[model samples]
Target: MTKFLKTSLGLVAATSLLFSCNEFKVTQETDGSKFQIHEKGDGKTTAKEGDIVTFDLVIKAPNDTVFTDTYKRKEPIVMPVQKGAFKGSFDNALTHLSAGDSATVYVSADSLFMRVQQPLPPGVTKGSDMKFIVKIKSIQTMAEFQKAQEEKKNNEAKVMENYAQKNFPNATKTQYGMYRVVLKEGSGATITAGKSVKVDYTGKLINGTTFDSSVGREPIEFSVGQGAVIPGWEQALMMMKKGEKSIFFIPSNLAYGEQGSGPIPPFSPLIFEMEVIDVK
Candidate 1:
């Protein structure tokens, strides 16, 4: 997760050098860090510690060498605001802005790398500065965020339930809230934890959009109880025997949950048609 944080926060170095830094009067933070606000927001509320923040970020090195830009990726980061690991850290910088504000914060590269316990990248020196360009998109209190998340979860559950009822009314619901319909029963003992299994699967969204499949390719193999796959897949596979073919309706809680992967949307329930070919 530390690596993920580093990447998401745009700590890595990028090859392209773009955007020239313009001169502006710098405001010194209480921690001695400096930032220049390019745009002031009209928001009345300021972000506080423990608040959930959604924002776009761009990290750059000297000479405007881009490290990462969330705006280009079109995925704004959403995270809880916490105290900085050091005086001039990004976390500390966030508290100084409100929704819709745009600012560029400057921090020492040495201190920044030290906080994340990562070695400085090539061409970066100890006393050099790293630039963080941030755009505040939204902020919500913990209670408000939790309430919204609960509402989204409930809505997703209803969607999945409706889809299951309409398509596979006789599907068996699992303890983890997923539904499964066995298409073909396999012979021999049921799969157990630590056993290696080979499977071919086609995964789809509730809207019938296929995201991934193993058709016309080598079947994927993994050991049961290993974290190589989602919890739903492991649970469902454990309930089946060799040669069994089943379709699983996996709820977001048992799958990707709030932070969806690549093409999957947040709070999305997934559908998978799976066949266990071999168990050893």
Candidate 2:
């Protein structure tokens, strides 16, 4: 299952039905899960196994409580359609959708928890149903998805390159695509893998929006090469000596990639002003 779907599962609880069963034609899956098409799409392309699907989702709990709503987030869930993870899984429900189609899927709460190997949340019981309201946004083949991703990456790279040229004219481009400018040199051994270091930093996007900082707070400590931070930070810190201050222009691939972290948009380039305070 995709991240959004997993989040929905964790939030699942017993919920009242939004519609009567007689109102819509329900089709049952091989594993006894069911779905009803609320609106048919005009597109002729139907999703199939191995294709990538983008869809908005809404999971509702009892008393009209929304467990999750992709529409509010403004990003739809995208995943490759595959064989159902279990009988009556969303994988089967997805096969019945086409671009622009809207449907409601009913899945067993108990089966969902069992498949994920997690205990049910409060208010959910052994045989309760979970409701998924989905709107199929698009479907693309694997090749198509890869091509689109490549295009996005290339576009972001160009934007970052321009930003670096204008802002840090003398920045050195690392082999992995990060741009670095040494603001202050320190005399001591440079940081290396397995070394623990404490650093104060302010992180921002390419457009100069500060997302995080450690100026007033105590410096964060982490071990080099321990995967404690983003790849960009790991690489940048390794090149610095204790007390050195540097500015780094990190590309999305080294920062958050396509799945951006909180307050960072996907494919965003990041800027960091960092000072290594201690090394051990």
Clashes of each: 0, 1
Give the alpha carbon lDDT tens digit for every residue of 14-118 in model 2. 222334444467888665658988888875888889999989899864334678898776557888999887778877888877898999888788888889898
Q: Provide TM-scores for the models.
A: 0.63, 0.62
At residue 136, give the lDDT of candidate 1: 92
lDDT of each: 0.87, 0.85
Q: Please report, as a residue range, the 10-residue window in candidate 2 with the lowest summed lDDT.
A: 13-22
Candidate 2 Cα lDDT to native: 0.85
RMSD for each of the candidates: 12.7, 11.9
- Evaluated at residue 27, the lDDT of candidate 1 is 77
Clash count, predicted structure 1: 0
Clashing pairs in 2: 15-62
**Per-residue lDDT of model 1, residues 1-280, tens digit only:** 9989888666333312222233345778886667888887866768899999988899998767888898776567888999988888888888888888888999889998887799988767779889999999888999998898778888987888888999999999898899999999999999999999999999998878778899999999989998989999999998999999999999998899987885576788999999999999
Weakest ten-residue segment in model 1 by summed lDDT: 14-23
